[model samples]
Target: MAFLIRKDFPLRGFATCGDCGSNLRSSWSKGKTKYYPYYLCQSKGCDSYGKSIPRDKIEGAFADVVKTLEPSPNTWCGLKPCSDVHGMRDWLKPKILRV
Candidate 1:
């Protein structure tokens, strides 16, 4: 029996190569505990290695981007309630958000 190897970032996910003009390939390195994931250029003769950017840093940046677009209480109140799935369902029932 043969198994297929799947990659996280596919061909469409590649942005661009730093050194070469080709597309960059993403891979992960096996660490002692977890895998160290990164993206690298597939072009030959390129001296550039995988960027050192981590997953958490990217997530934080994305959160900051979302925070910038957040609406104030006054502006948010004017919007109509969405569908049942999207709207608050019995927010008055109980509150135990914090530990």
Candidate 2:
């Protein structure tokens, strides 16, 4: 018997360049004995010249960051959502109307 498998991709279209504010894309090299995937910036007139960052290096760095993440009561309190409404005054609201 055979089984079919599926995967979910949450990072399909969100990563971007910090310099040009452009979307980053991924590609795989062809005609190779082994697979190699990389990410590149995809923007016109941008200084980022589609440089490739190795998948292994990126994953290792991300693993380090994840390992450093720790949760505590103080950390949770520091992340509380803001509840201020000072900017909702009549004068501060947008002056446009639509039908």
Best by lDDT: 2
Largest TM-score belongs to which candidate? Answer: 2
Residue-wise lDDT of candidate 1 within 33-79, one digit each (tens)? 98986556665677665444443443354456546665678977776
What TM-score, over all chains together, does every model reach? 0.39, 0.51
Stretches off by above 4 angstroms in model 2 are 1-14, 73-99
Instruction: Give lDDT tens digits, candidate 2, residues 10-86.
Output: 22233346567554566666545876766567777777757765655544554565577677878667653434323
Lowest-sum lDDT 10-residue window in model 2: 1-10
lDDT of each: 0.46, 0.48
Off by over 4 Å in 1: 1-7, 10-12, 49-99
TM-score, structure 1 vs. true? 0.39
